[model samples]
Target: MDFKNSTENNEKVDANYNVVPLREAMCKTERRLRRKIDIFVVPTVMLMYLMCFIDRANIGNARLAGFEKDLKLKGYDYNTVLSIFYVGYILFEIPATMCCKIMGPGWFLPLATVGFGACSIATAFVKTRAQVCAVRFLLGIFEAGLMPGCAYYLSRWYRRAEYSFRLGIFFSTVPLSGAFGGLIASGILKLPHLGSLKGWQMIFAIEGIITVAIGLLAFVTMTDRPETARWLTEEQKELAINRVKSERLAQAVLLDRIDATKLKRGFTNPITLATSFIFFLGNVTVLGISFFLPTIIRTIYPSRTTIDQQLLTVPPYIVGALLLLLISGLSWRFDHRQAFIILTGPTVFAGYAIFLATINANIRYAAVFLSASTAFALGVMSNAQVAANVTSDSARNIALGTNAIFGYCGALLATWTYLPWDSPKYMLGNGINLACAATWTIVGIGAAAWMVYDNKKRDERQAAGMEEIVGLSQLEIQDLEFRHPAWRWKL
Candidate 1:
């Protein structure tokens, strides 16, 4: 009887140990699903954004292709055209976000991309300044939701800890687009057989076609979520969904239903207002440099051919892309986002200041490259950092959209502020960019200080509630008043 009992006990221990293989198998399946999602997610987003950014800024290259001279543009007329793009963009941004929520990214994002592409292609045929402005405005209307939409969509798949690195990869395409745009524009400008159609017109026609094609491809392939993705196994899908929810729940302070009323409340919040203002200031500095940097380079190197001028624009974007990747990686590894922003802000300002003081061709070129690259990193890091700090899903979506709108508003202001009339030595434009950079630095400092103070209060509150056994929702914990100890900001 004793021998029999010992054997049975050993068999039970063996059964318990057998469960380990199942756990290992599940983990492997989850990892495979994650890899599949990333393969689709990273490329789709990066490509879409690349096209969006290229379409918006292609005007810079258009200017070099004799666009201004052909249209008889005078004294900020071109500026007005640039600014009008944002009017349509800002008007449609919020609506686009809502549409994404209703329709899912699989449908809405592609439709928007196609619409903008068609509008961009049509722009090539415009004969007058008014026609150009109208086409750009329409294009902006279609493209308005893309950036925020992608940001929000990706958030659905990734955990908060993973978001910054993914965002950095997605955002890195902006500078890469700048680099690729120069190369493409250079080749198109050299084409001689396109019938009286200028190089700039050809650039638009070809790029728009590519955008439409890519959009069509995305629509057919993009799966909305892991649970709904046909490629994922049942176990894989459950793991993916649960992992994201668990991360969000861990970070959330209050758990409220995300509804229309909550959205309205989010839109009206004071923090949202301050965040929007910061986005506006940062974007002014960003778009100002993007639209005018090439022009400024051309002024300094007036005798160079179109190809040479476009080539000159390369170094800045290259340096900018590298620095952006480095900073984003370090920020994620150390969980120290605010400190990086504070350090990067001055690199941008210094770059602008150097450009303002230089007249020598070599020195001016160096300054422009340094400024452009440094500003690229600063703009990207600041936007992603702020977006990560907000806990409400509705609030985050609206905040992201509002921030983009505000940034474009800055772009609109930049259009007129840095007119062709200013040309070679754009004293006003340079000064404005410098001032904007300085102001953003100050804003970064203030945001960091607020985060620190809020964190302290949260710690105190959590300590006081040690005896409570109640389960608080994420929003409640996230709220400043009901602060939880785990509610500290991620760098």
Candidate 2:
């Protein structure tokens, strides 16, 4: 709506179009486009991430269903299976992101889904611990593309202010998948062995088949970007494209050009490092609980059957999913990402602190709820916060890839978290988690302060006319992608 009156004073306009008409059109077009995108992109990606997460996660379920016992896994063998996947996961993330961008998300995402889904299917038939670990590693290679690629893809559709809400919707699937996967596993595990397949085998096969079906459908339903969204009118498309481009311009970022130096700068940025560390710690909490929640529940209710364990897992995850959405929405409505994020650290810390203090199964069970509801939700906010700070697509991708690598490293660490020696009462692991929670809280405070300081400095410099840049080419913007004095980070 901000516009200048032409010399004639009869019309308010800009070079692109008449401001009044454009705003009016955009008001309707953007809302509808968002609705369509919400319906199309969010569910599809959420389902994709759900399947992707469950494929990795179902191993824990499978373990409860006798995956480890049947294979005769000894000592750390099962943990190695969990940890090795992240090795491949860490290696393939950057390449998969590059592939997703090059091939277009619609095509690339589905292909990766199918690849990993097939690996999940292969996991059902593993004859040895070694075979299972190999399948998990290959599964990692395919699964690596999903989260980071989805993050980048979703960002294409909305501005930073609007982004966390959408990302929250997409990421809410993490806990939802756990809940759904629990319900699914509870049902699937009740089945009698069919043609030499155990209940756990059926779980992998059926879940993987569902993922493949979803992936095949993603090509039909998902669009690469708004500019190419066929469901929109050409006018809507133009307006949508310009909207995002304008946001980039306001942040002093280069639009539509890949700056090679962006990769270096994004990875090396102090802010990016701080945020990535936050992301890494967040993932540590996420994977540690996700992979070990059922085990934790089993400790609390030692007499329960596998079915009871599966069913019990549902409520905590369901709560986590709901809280994830609520927090994300509140963060967006208030425009305060950091505040919501810092609170999660205490929730995680309290979960562990309570566990470290008591041997009571009921209190420990309550601790599980605290851990489940906040850790992954915190990770969601962390990713959104990082995205808000990162302005360029390439830079965002690099920062994301770096985060993914660290995230998997957290996954790797998580695999070793609840050791065989620490069973039932994982006091040592809980202590480490408490320490991590404190680190996350402290660093988040520092990061928010840094943003406040930098924003204030930028305002001071701008008032003095000490900083200015406009309409720079990709070449001109080189070496100054996100650090441009005009770029102000979101806190």
Candidate 3:
């Protein structure tokens, strides 16, 4: 019944009567299935996230197109509006992501997309800072589920080792949205004002409409799971599902009905807490860069035209997008997440240090490239790392949701880090981000070291017969989740 010890090229029957195959025999089939899954599944989620990020981040673009001027936002009012979004975001993320499972991702993700898109559309008509805050808060409530939901959704479809790269592929949309959003905003800003909408209003209205269309398309394009995927054969579905099972703790089923005990294990897991905190630190940089990059660009090129400033924001995001793909691809190829995560420390430290240490316009501008490279890559690595550490579907959902809650709390901090008073050369903001990156390095190193230690201890316990797992029933073994004697943390 232990599929791990199954004979080569043979399918072993589990206690529940599922026939799981030895991974070695399925190489060619897996590659083909992976490609098919990539085509059918990845693109739908990627497009969804691309619009999700665009709709979320376009506020930065809107700011440059005179969003603040039009709304009469004064002093800390802009920061207040930005910070309020995360209040709804932080409070509802876990509940919404939990709902992502109960409602099915195919239905839930698109519904969330529509809700946030409508909120974004509503922003176009806001007349006061209070209106902006209200709309953004609603936007936050809708968007709260999206990133974590997409993460948990993708985790369902891929094996542990394959997750980081595929997640990277999905998250590549973050920087792409930044790039394309800028280009789109630049073009939109060039047009004459419509009936009552200014360039900024046009930006919100147009981008929101596109997001709504994509959300509607997702209803048809997304399949809830492999079993229901019409594009896949029964054979392929079984293979897809079993291959993932082969790598889980005690060969656990991919999806189990959610329950209170499993949910508690998810929220209390040490790996979840550690990775979520690391993600929190990472978000301070990522969200700061996202919401304020346009403002940074404006500061750097004050004499340039507004259109030129928008175009200038494009290059750093392009660089960030490329570096994210390259790094995450290597993480997948090498089958290591923590090492790559630890390796990002120096790059991020140097990036923020340059921003603080320099007054030279050209040099500070170049630092944006270094900063971009690692900002969003952490989101992929941390999510994948947490997903790998957990053992069940419900637990995975909660772990990812918990990760988002902490990460967005950091986002709340980022909103206020760059106040209007911190204008050209926002030394305090750069210093705060620099401190976050340094602290993140320490935490990343600590987490990796703990994983190494715990894995070794587990090995020692197993060797001494103190933690035997042989001949245990599937339910008993699976209830252990990451605590299983045979389960090792993916370092």
Candidate 4:
């Protein structure tokens, strides 16, 4: 009848509760629960993110439809417009994602989507460079929450090992957006003028309307947490919460109230900072390609019609999307994340290197496929790595948001990576991206090595009786979070 005593003793029971029959039955139950979670959660988040991405990057597609000419954007005006989005994005990311946790993702994500969707629609009405820049910045503010919010939300439903694949499934929308956006733009452009709207205006208007519709649907569909998931039975709900806590060194509870100490821990955790830097470097390549691929395609197939160029951008992203899912599945299967991230660096390095080495159209075009292969995949790896390494829910939110903050800084730089002056063979942009790829390879290797070394050190300390939690209550020990001796890095 004593609730506190019951919860404390439950941890002790779970430690020894691994009878094979029980384990097998629980595994089967978990599999069913997982399928239900996937069905209810995954597609909704994926569509939300797909719309988020398409709305953000449609400017590139708009450019192909003479957006610059129509708006009288000259000199570095286009780059300025792109760069301003990241200004609001980078500044708002941590705050927005923190709000996602406090307010609950179900409400936070849908509302943010509506804000950005409306911004996208408003973009269709912008008649000048300054107006577009203003709308884009507001769009960034709304979108700032969705990626890290979704990442943090999924981490609640899944165990550390299960997270990367789900993250990959949703994050695969990055490349999928590129592919779909191009096809959408090309198809839209092929249509006759929609009343008074230009091709580019039609692109913004149509994509924005669909985004708002998806946002409205999400409100009816999104479940805030396992405890609140109406589709789940009582037993399944209990199982969902317990399994997540069981992985976190048998922590006492699944969610904790947000606090300053946990927020600071999230910001200062060494793994969080390191993986975030690696993500920052990867974004330089990812966003650079996202914002400028259409222009690059134009250079590659100079004589091709506008629609053909739009169509050409599709293949690289398709290749990237497939690879993103494949690597995520392998990461989940092997329960290894950093090694795959380390491998991606070299693949991207070769990609940028080829871009630098050739003006030969076919070969450089092949390089786009190579570059696209891993830029987006790193997003899944880095986010999952940070989430896995952290312990508490509040800390996970901050860590993922921190990673995203650094990522948008890289995106800000990406806006200028491919300048108009560097057209037809952009050696400058290629060189910068190649350097990022090389640097990411080195950093990834070092971070992985350090994790292995630190785990061994923690083991040695434990063996020496240095990690005594004897006087601590279960809740207090759980409060220690990642600092607890039982906590190990999920490399």
Deviation in angstroms for 274 in model 3? 1.2
Model 3 lDDT tens row, 450-475: 99999888887876543476676777
Q: Clash pairs of candidate 3?
A: none
List, residue by residue over 1-491, the lDDT tens digit for candidate 1: 12223334555675546756555665576567668778877788888888988888888988888888888887778888898899999899999987776787778888888888888788888889999999988998999889888887787776665666677788887787788888888988888846656678898888899999989988887776666778777866766666665544233322233466446544654445555666677677767767776788788899998789987887788787888788777766775666776666687788778878978888888877666665666655655665565555665677677777777788788887676666677878888888887887787788778877877776777656544525765444444321334546554
Question: Between prediction 1 and prediction 4, which has the larger lDDT?
Answer: 4
Give the best candidate by TM-score.
4
RMSD (Å) of each candidate, 1 decimal: 6.2, 3.4, 3.7, 3.1
State model 1's lDDT.
0.74
Sliding window of 10 residues with minimal summed lDDT for model 2: 1-10
Q: Which ten residues in a row have the lowest lDDT in candidate 4?
A: 1-10
Error of 2 at 396 (Å): 1.6
- Stretches of candidate 3 off by over 4 Å are 1-25, 463-474
**Higher-ranked by TM-score: 3 or 4:** 4
> For every model shown, what is its TM-score relative to the native structure?
0.88, 0.93, 0.94, 0.95
lDDT of 4 at 469: 80
On lDDT, who's better, 2 or 3? 3
Predictions in order: lDDT: 0.74, 0.81, 0.86, 0.89
Candidate 2 colliding pairs: none
